[model samples]
Target: MESPITPFEPAIADEAIADLQQRLKLTRYPDEETVEDWSQGIPLAYVRELTDYWSAEYDMGRVCGTLNQWPNFLTEIEGLDIHFIYQRSPHSDATPLLLTHGWPGSVLEFRHVIDRLSNPTEYGGRAENAFHVVAPALPGYGFSAKPRAPGTTVQKIADLWIALMKRLGHERFLAHGGDWGSLVTQAVAVAPGTTCAGIHITLPVVAPDPETLESLLPEEVQALEAFNFYQDWDSGYSKQQSTRPQTLGYGLADSPTGQMAWIIEKYAQWCDCEVNGLRHPENAIPRDELLDTVMLYWLTNSGASSARLYWESFNNPDMAEIELSSAISLFPNEIFRSSERWARKKFLNLHYFNDKIAKGGHFSALEVPDLLTQELWQWREQLRALEIVA
Candidate 1:
């Protein structure tokens, strides 16, 4: 039976571009933060400069062209149009790998690494390490259709992805994700009817075992401090989105600058972009790429719809014990860091674990594609030793 997947390409209209340019020109300014650093939020001066570039210099066509370069398609899964980039490897023996993106990020997060994963030899990687990459836009994100009704949780998205892979002709595959993607990938790893061979994640959504607190390792202590910091200072956005996303959506939907500031602030806060005490998102990811992610939200008017995922699933994450073979890479600046002991508590058959990443943060795929690609390649070797993907 043939799958009902339709080829997709973004047909952004001239008027939408004109409207964005005009909106940028007419953006309302706010008073600068009193603090010197980003203690309050994204600096006003930087926002103005970036928005100006977006208005005058940046090529709006980059978004369309970047996605069009890959094999993008739309398929109806559970009555919603799910958008994804299905890039097959030139290597015939490559395994299928599902890459899911999280909130404040779309499939754009995987843009740099997709080619690296799907076509390894072209980028100096062994053909045996290649994979058929399937990066899907979360429901209500990017070109994917929004959920009009309620109850589109992470678990539902996992089920949808399982069906999507089978429809695409892959019965068994590897899965990798970070942030919200990590949670969905967990669901896929343990979903009852899933065919997942193994899993790798940057963020292991495992809580610290109470027993370990009495004799905490140095890294475990730092992980606790980071988790506390997130709860104290950085979780305001999560609170808003999980509580009243619809109310937050109006501003994000109407003002281009509002949308830009909302998303870029996370990149600055979550990315390992700091140098000599100052943090700038452009240090980790280029300014154009930062704007590229914002444009996906602006063009699709998905500011509110995307936030609702938090409303539906943030408070109710699926944290079941995963017995599947698992590999976890703990990036230094990720929001929550877990030690191998903690991860082993949840991932019973843990195959690989590394917390020695010298750099990179929550947005690892964007900040350090080379390092992220290397980690994936390393994980594949472990799977191969066990014959998980041959």
Candidate 2:
């Protein structure tokens, strides 16, 4: 017999909201950064402004209402209750698509494009292009229940996701992901048990083979340089999360300001902000949308649990090579960019590859939903064509 699935609507107690306000009011800020720019991390002034807005102006009710607008549910899967937003397209034959979010993100990242992808005809597209969307919060992120013990690796999450789709009555589906989610999606595609048709990812994590390193193309060299720069500068959070998430989680769990800064800093650095000549992420993504994501982490107290994923599967050796039908949409402002030559080495059955997304960054769905939506639709057609030929 199948485990029962229950409809769920998240509700934080009044006491919890009151306590958050009291903590925000009592926040003790650190000294201002010696540097003027974000190079030293989120500046004191920027954090202050965000916290002030959060404590005084931001409305939690609005965020909750937006979330409740969707059909949310929880189902027991592999000894844990999984939270997800499952929206079936009106068209009976709509393709089933599973969207997995990464660190510092929740199902909210796909909020803007969910309706459009599920009902393309309403948005100037064909009904045949519509998709039945299933976006699940990772085991320790958003509304999903956090694992008490260790061993919730990306591979394990992929296995759980396949089970989830099967339980929902989908035997085959397409998957898309970004950031750490890309790792999970790739795992799903390659897993022997998965009935996945194909996979799409915003960034394809591929490193040049040592044998091919001697004759690097100009773009490949640039990609390597970009990766190095990320390792040197932007990777402090990853290292810390992977090494000591418990220690780091204390501050994040105790202080909303700390949590906001920790997450917002990534948006400023990883999004299309620099291209738009904006110093902060709010200039690219709406402030409320950003805060909505932060609220998920804060309410669930998932700061540490979410970070544990890095410890479990960051740079796992098994992910280095994948031989499956794959598509990659390369956003220019993304931290790491893999050239077609480099990606082809691993994704041997690369059906679609486009590296010239004029806008967006690491958070392609949130930063450039329209472009990502279009790419997913186009890639679906390409994947179908390949299946026919095969």
Candidate 3:
């Protein structure tokens, strides 16, 4: 596969600076006594502070240079020019693993944890647990071909990643993801293959049994209530992404601040059990770092294509029955979406058993890379042991 010629993207330094100025110039000030708090979105004041940081102190060169330090390459797959970072561990026995990034998130999410996972010894991990990381832009997300058409969905992406692993000469491998990324990895898992030996992830979606929900202890039931609230109040972005992404794109595409505001709310709320989690001081990544996460999307002009994934899936012909089975509730939102029997009929795995990082929010790889790396190592070991014993 031929790599996409790295395009000469506009120097983000002046571009981001100029963009921030435009935002401040033409920005329509919102009413102070507005509807409510962040529930509606990032406060105008909050975004101004963030944009101020972007224009002044935010370091794009350092971030991009750090990204460039890795072996960035482009390859052709099914006619689309794909972009990725290929880092091979020196250890001969290092396992092969593929990591997927979701909406409004670039490969930058994994940048924090790549070395930790690929070189475990330096990170207090055994050499045997090392991995050769394959972090790819979801077809339209990063440097990969941003398909402007309507057909690409998570299923197609899973197939593409499978093909990608083969292209890299790996006959077998494992997968990990979160947010939309988690859903796609799960599809790859249910696929028939010995090569895709085991899959693990932080963002999980599974079915719940109504009878079980009825029988759960009071504490368990509380979590279920929170899950239901998310489906009702917290799903607007998902609904919009699945339906009218272009409309949202119009706003997000041109304005850097708009893009930051669009994704920052989710980063603040979706990764944690509560909105307060976004403000947690002990969190591995601070809110400023979270703004940096949004800037990646803004600088790359990915908000449109990233949100396009929603419309593709929601309109999928196979949408009638999304197969998701789990014996345990994975995310707080899954409780209200499906029943255990239904999920079983759909997804091969039901995760009703764990809340691993049940504390952290979506961008887990970026927010808490150490926690993500350590947990991923443990998951692989558990999967290996289970496969051997079985």
Maximum-lDDT candidate: 1
lDDT against true structure, model 3: 0.66
Better of 1 and 2 by lDDT: 1
TM-score of each: 0.98, 0.96, 0.83
Q: Give the alpha-carbon lDDT of every model.
A: 0.93, 0.86, 0.66
Q: Tell me the tens digit of each residue's lDDT in model 3 across 1-390.
A: 343434222235676656656664565555653755666666777777777776667665644665676777777777777888888887778888888887667787888788998899999998878899988888777566788566677788888888888878887887777767777787676655535766665554544455566577554565567677877788888888888888888888877777777877666565543544344321445655666667667666778788888888744423223333222224433223333354455445543334534444566677557767777777656655656211
**Local lDDT at 371 for model 2:** 91
Off by over 4 Å in 1: 1-3
Query: Cα RMSD (Å) per model?
Result: 1.1, 1.6, 4.2
Model 2, residue 350: displacement in angstroms?
0.4
Which runs in model 3 stand beyond 4 Å of their true positions?
Answer: 1-26, 33-36, 192-194, 217-220, 273-284, 314-353, 356-358, 387-390
* Cα lDDT of model 1 by residue, 1-390, tens digit: 444988998769999999999999999989999999888998999999988999989999999888888999999987889999999999999999999999789899999999999998988899999999999999999999999999889999999999999999999999999999999999999899899999999999888999988999999999999999999999999999999999999999889999999999999999999899888888999999999999999999999999999999999777778999999998899999988999999999899999998899999999999999999999999899988777
Q: What is the lDDT of candidate 2?
A: 0.86
Weakest ten-residue segment in model 2 by summed lDDT = 381-390
